[model samples]
Target: MTDTLALAGRLLLAALMFAGTAQKLASPTEAQALLALASLPPWLIWPAALFTAIAGIGLALGLATRPLAILAAAYCVVTSTFHVLMDDPWQMTIAFKNWVIAGGYLLLAAHGPGRFALRRD
Candidate 1:
């Protein structure tokens, strides 16, 4: 069912974002290196980490799924742009991931969270 698929996708993305945030938190130096490679402002590093973690938690719980997905999609877009600018061939991977995530977000945004969502009031 579409609901099942969406839930699975949302959970997967949440896990991915959580892992990324953990990496950033556990190894800030590595995070800094990647951010530097992306040319993102150093000050943004911590805020970005926090946003990703919070958004991931929200999406996983199906709470404000649409808005959180949108925020996550925006974050993915920003990071994808940086990867593209870096000329990393991995950018292609990031692009596809971002696109899929954005699609999921758009679907949730349009369809509400379907059944099985916390907001299914």
Candidate 2:
């Protein structure tokens, strides 16, 4: 039961993150605007966006979940901190969402994906 729930949670978060990354890719201008609002440099936006997309796919597929989760957690923390510190109203919700995702990633990192993951042997 716990494994099922965790798997579901991971899938949902992965989908959400992937969607976000897609949006960034589809509309770089919009993404850059948001990043600017958060005071992030323009050069860093593309790399961050790419990593988020790849990490989301990795998490969804249960491949390298530990390292990917750690990377995602770190990215979430940095992005959330940027949002909070910049006082971006549009990003406040994202900041909270990132924190939640960070917690989920950390949990997965510590516990592994159990039997529900694709990588389970």
lDDT of each: 0.75, 0.78
**Candidate 1 accuracy as TM-score:** 0.80
Model 1 residue 31 CA deviation (Å) reads 3.0
> Which residues of candidate 1, in runs, are more than 4 Å off?
85-87
lDDT tens readout by residue for model 1, 8-103: 877887897898799888877866766787766666779978988998888788888888877777777767665553456676777777777777
Clashing pairs in 1: none
Counted clashes in each candidate structure: 0, 0
Best by TM-score: 2
lDDT of 2 at 111: 80
lDDT digits (tens) for residues 3-117 of candidate 2: 8877887787678679878877787787676678777777777887789889888788887888888888888888786567445676688788889889988987888766777
Where does candidate 2 stray beyond 4 Å? 37-39, 85-90
Model 1 error, position 107 (Å)? 2.1
Native-to-model Cα distance after best TM-score fit, residue 16 in candidate 1, in Å: 1.9
